[model samples]
Target: MSQATETLVFIPEDISSARSGAFRADWQMRSLAGETMGTHWSAKFSSPEQLDLQAIELSITQNLDTVISQMSPWETDSDLRRYQKAASGSWCAFRPEAFHVLERALSIAQETDGAYDPTFATAVDLLGFGPSPHSGYSYASPEVQQAFAQAGYQKAALSAETNSLFQPGNLRVDLCSIAKGFAVDLVCQRLRELGLENYLFEIGGEAKGLGCKPDGLPWLYEIEPPPNAKASLSKAQVALCGLAVATSGNYLRYEQRHGQTVAHIVSPRCQDGDDKLLSVSIFHDSCMEADAYATALFLLGAEAGLAFADKRNLAALFQTADDLLLSGRARKLLG
Candidate 1:
């Protein structure tokens, strides 16, 4: 059997090497993990002398539930689903949290010329990649075509002052590309409010870190190499310090449609599966930005994607069918 790629793996560090001065003498390395958004999440941090694991876990779960309630398209009562069901040409009162995500998603979509779009909800459902999977969905069907037609970021307008959103068409927004990363950042924020630093936060494959270990060493992460025949997850690791990382890969999350295999990622330009690149990883100060850009660059393919990252001096790594490429800044970070 071909092993599935690990995608992202935590690299354990020797506690002795971490800086100790910032923490108490009794400080200990601790790890916490849970499942959320249909995937697992984890956190590692150096704790001071006293910490309440139970309270922290409860807070984490509550925050993640709030995130899902606001943005998950899978939930019928979610704010996103409510917006999708809203009548066209009507402005709906939007939750500030959901609007924030949409605003950032729209910004990235515009920057990438619609490569990373939040308006793929219908396409996602038709492709059997959404909460409810269906067989026999076709890209050529009128329903699917209509879904494509509703997919322009320009069609959605946000009012920051009123916290309202206008859907100009039958547009339905999906935040799968960026919500998890935003959730990770929120969890990190929660930790900060509790007076904790030196933590690594990850949900699904999106991750962010702040401060350093007790010994003051940055968290390390292993980005699986280009998938192989066996599809094992083994590769060189990178160190991340006060940064965030997110990756998009076509090896997994695929479905069979019309007797052909297709990736789950939907491109706004093609309104179909994007298959040009094998994988792309993005590093940024904000996990949300990294998550959205990773999907965007993957859809842009190797040449244009690399150029995009290079022009912005973004830290990114791209893996193609035949070669591995890194943005100049990413190369330096990896080096």
Candidate 2:
């Protein structure tokens, strides 16, 4: 058995003791047919990059973040801002690749029946989303609330002709859905640039493992099913066959405010629904896809989310807040 161990290495901090800033990246490898890797992360950049390894990490991640920034409604000065400022409904042009990502978001939105939406920016904000400073943006639209209940991601029109978007000005999109996965893609690209084929890339809770580790083994990841579920309750080995894994749940983000346990995972379609299911983990061909899908599944709650996964033929694990039986597909994946 190849032993897997993680060590935090910094080029600036360790080598030169420079005060540039802290950059966080993980490089854990093992040598064997298979090995296990585990990391706990929160999505988003905390500090800065100040090391050689950190510089390499920044070069890749910053580019990835740029792609997501162009997609996020959260950015005040973003290219997306033009649409928000459109006098009526204006055409918002996107880079071809960026447009493709939006197109993909729309596609997944359709596949999930708008259950996993990218256009939840307004709803998310109204529910007091964003970082610490920008809190408490309330919802005042019975009409808007109704809109969310029957929200269809198809409502937004994309013009590959103009590389633009046409939707209600209030309709904003957030790439947090698939951005982490996309970041993994960028990270992998950079790893290739650095001639690193055997490495694991994890951002927040999303992960993408490429090739074998330095220890020479397939990457081993742990699966955390929803709490109180029959699936592996604690950390255990999961087969890592070049797949990216992501989990979405409200267990950590919940806060009791004014008698309501407000969770950040908002249903782009529901402003107020007591979603009981705790968390959902998805395995997919790519980390980005899996990340977005898992988040959407978590937002869909227990029944609808599971149904959506079944329809898509994706493998997943779902654990509700209280112990509940999962369908055949989820059970098998979690097991």
Candidate 3:
């Protein structure tokens, strides 16, 4: 029988180098976890002082709650839903957090040429993957076609000065692809504000790490293998020092319809999910970017996605049924 393999990738750093001060003998590893956005979030950090764990948890939960209030499509009163309900041509003001996420989402949509549109909420709902009851609409159905017609990120406009978004006649916005990662970033920021530096923060599967462990070792994160992967497949892990990683795949959230496998990730380009690649993982300095890029690359497929990553010099790993493909930058990270 073939044995499984493991690959550790990291940027070389001195063992004695510590961004959060030299690891103290008294420093202890602390952990916290909570539920949010129909998922779980966790944190592991090194701290020397006797910190109030309860207070830290409260702050983290509050930060996550703020993201849901502003961006969650399931929340009827959320800023995103409110904007969706607004009449066309009217500009709706939003909180700084919501505005920031929307701005970034649009920027990415433009960058990927609508491959990662934020205005595909209607299509997502029609395909039985979103908050609304699925309409049982096929890709050729009128409902699905109309949804696709209206699903263009260019239709929307943002006013940075006012922190507002213009709704272009029933344009529905969904930030599901990027919101959770933003929440992770928010938690990391909160940790820093609380004077804790050496930490690994994660929401759902997206994660970001700061500083180093108490023993001066970087926090290591193992990429999740695809479902039913062979035992001989090599496991790849990266040291999460000052980096965030996100993975998108069809195996996690997909359904069978009429003998067709429909994934949850609805591409704006085609109004259907693309399962050509088993999964795509993106590594960046920001969790939000990593999360959005992972979804985009998954929709773009293996060939085009590889080209996109290479053009941007992005660190990306694309996994197919028979092969593991890494971008030029990704290959450099292997130790």
Candidate 4:
């Protein structure tokens, strides 16, 4: 796998603490890592004593399983799958977790003018990047068009009072864009419940951090260069403190279909031409939101994506073929 060149490292204060043995004597740094959502996840925290590492790892895995059960497009028995097969115009209630994710998705779709739609499952599957009944279909085929026509995030009516969702027609929902980040956020919460105030949690490259190291310094992450780029390239690092970051890029995930290479990300607007934008990274208070926005910004390409980010005052970094651009908000925050 191509690695993100930027690695998180302990700051000078942390090095000093390690040398003095002031923090290590009183606190133990424990770590757990495992697989989730077709990728790996990890958690690192400082605690005064040894923890039930086995139980904590199991809980983290179970949490990821719960998310997959609710959102995986590959699973036929998933709640989303059942909803997709349900009769049109029928109401399907969601579990609390699924409900919350869908609610946020719909809101983001509206906010981005459908830039980050959960209803792009058809296009995604058609591209052979997702599982489905729609795979192997050409992008311009009637079936793909019909599926796109039938799906729209706006059409799905939500009722918070009843915790029920009503599909206007044959809309199929896929939560791939934001589900992993939500899982990361959930793990962070679990860590807090274990009385861990200083920790970092990551799932599928989307990460969030809280508090600080025992030495009172923040966790740092080096944003990597685009995939396939020479690793000798350097990028900036950001300190994580009650913040989450997510990156979306086609360089990492794409497949050749019909003699043409198509990326995994599908734009609801129209076919993207000569996709020049390489990658996008977003920072936000919520990992889920960061994930969703990263995808949206990537779909919008460089110019429009930068404009949108600036308009929303979002902290976003867009990497193009030749250079890296930071939104005004990102510069203000990271500069």
Candidate 5:
């Protein structure tokens, strides 16, 4: 990593609540702060908007966690549960903002042909991500498979006028589709509002770079598989500016099932796991789009993913398990 000309590590721990998914904020900022006079703003900043953004993020995450997380039994009592309680019924009222996000998710799902949707709640649930936090894997009933199999986001209905979301609709909305990317975008908005034009906004592995680092050069980062794997960036680096970059892969999120490696990413068409394209990195004007496409591309496989990206004029890179980075339209954009 090249030295950052100047860096600011502003982590207002006391001012911020721990709702951003145990992020790499502290350590990442510390790494950037090494031997620098950059201020670490763990204290409440002077700007009210900064505090407000933090609060909003925490609240949104909590509300989302309420729906998606099986952590607490009571969270099932939420609007999502309301739909489940209908006992083979009709539409229902939902939190307006939640519904908005859900509606967006469904739109992406429709556009992506179910590649990105809340329907995966069942797939993820079976993989051990609910109330227990990490359920690993479990033997599920055929009936359970049938139940979840029917839970596609397309089944849900949303009225912009009513601003509510519900099932056909027996499904619930999960924003694993775009929540982290949304949060990154929101943080960028907040930073811009605070006159912090030059900053890197990141949540999860999704990140957006704005302006240059305190140094004059553009912000740069290498792509690597999740930790525990040996260094895999191939000594290649991408400079990020005014764009979001995200990577999704299977090696780190796989389990042995039926004598095969069952990964988190389920192909909506095959209902099977796709392992050919180990990782996909996408860059776009919106982090949400980038994040969404990263997953979508992974599901698309190499040939189809390139075709989709080319058709959309999207810039993307797909890394195979063998460590070859294949750029689709993205190669020209990086220049």
Candidate 6:
């Protein structure tokens, strides 16, 4: 077993510094939560007088459901499932939101050189992390090899004008790496539409914040440390003002095979998983980007990931059993 040996401290900055105006003092803090995407979704916002909490909650749930209906691999009728079953060279149309997410996922895949891929549904399922139950397929098994051969972001084509995706036979798309963060963004959009400017929105652990709290303080979010971290390691917290933060770690989801731990986050380039780096956390203006980058960085492993983050100027923190690595941008932010 390994332990986290260092800490990064982040001070909460004034939200008004990032926004145009100060928050109103008369507003009250309100919270609403519900289940979505097989996990919980929550909101903490500065509510205006006479605001209808129930109606807002309903709208948030509906928006989350919309993402599931379009992107969920578990949903048989989802747009992704439809595209998966489409014949080779056929264009499958998608709703605007889903199309946008798919487009972004592919972009990240290309940027990372396929370290992160959305077309790994079959591989994911065989690795015991997808919609279907695992069937004892080893990494070197023929079934797994065939699934890997079929998974590649470049194999699919996107049409920006038509909002459609081209299916190349047996190519399955899974947005699990990025969809939850998109849901958080969608919820935040709804909140803004209702004139709520100060709030924190989250789905599954990916989160975003807008403006300030009712007390004029930024929303403080605690970064989750790796499971093997030392108890004495000081905790890290970030001021989520006009920003989103996402963390991905091997401990979040895994399985034991042949007395070794196998993480759910598989590297498409390697066609396998590596748990050497405990986790990676990324901060960005968009929760979706933060989420995808976290996965991509983790797959790239510690040294390469840190270099990539620095080159890209991404605020990223990578933690392993005995070491902690931070990009130049992450150091500036934490310092």
Per-model CA lDDT versus the true structure: 0.76, 0.58, 0.83, 0.76, 0.55, 0.81
| Model 5 TM-score, 2 decimals | 0.70
| Residues 1-335, model 5: lDDT tens digits | 12222221111122122121122222222112111011121111112122344554454344334333421222656565565556545667666545655666677778777766766665555555432375445334363466467777666767778765555644544455465566556556666655544456555567776555333445565665544332533434555556667777776666775555656555444245455567788777677778777877777777888888888877777666544445546656544
Residue-level error in angstroms, candidate 4, position 51: 2.0
**167-233 per-residue lDDT for model 3 (tens digits):** 8788898899999889988989888899887989998899998888888778888888897566566
Clashes of each: 5, 11, 0, 0, 8, 0
Global local distance difference test of model 6: 0.81
The TM-scores of all predictions, comma-separated, are 0.87, 0.72, 0.93, 0.87, 0.70, 0.92
Q: Which stretches of candidate 2 lie over 4 Å from their true place?
A: 1-55, 131-152, 224-237, 268-275, 322-335
lDDT of 1 by residue, 161-278 (tens): 8777787767788899889888988888898898876788888778887767776566776666555423352354555556788998778776566655556777544444545567
Best model number under TM-score: 3
Candidate 6's residue-wise lDDT over 1-335, tens digit each? 13543556653233456554356778888899889888888899775566788999899989999999999999999999899789888999999999999999999999988888988788888878888877655566678778888788888888899999898788898899999889888888888888877889888789998887777777888888788865655566777888889999878777667554556776544434555688898988889999999999988888899999999999897877665677888777773
Better of 1 and 5 by TM-score: 1
Best candidate per lDDT, number? 3
Over 4 Å off, model 3: 1-4, 12-20, 268-274
Worst 10 residues of 2 by lDDT: 7-16
Residue 305 lDDT in candidate 6: 93
Residue ranges of candidate 1 with Cα displaced over 4 Å: 1-26, 229-234, 268-276
Over 120-143, each residue of candidate 2 has an lDDT whose tens digit, in order, gives: 655666566642254543343453
Show model 6 residue runs off by greater than 4 Å: 1-7, 11-15, 19-21, 24-26, 268-274
- Model 4 lDDT tens row, 77-106: 887888878787898888899889989988
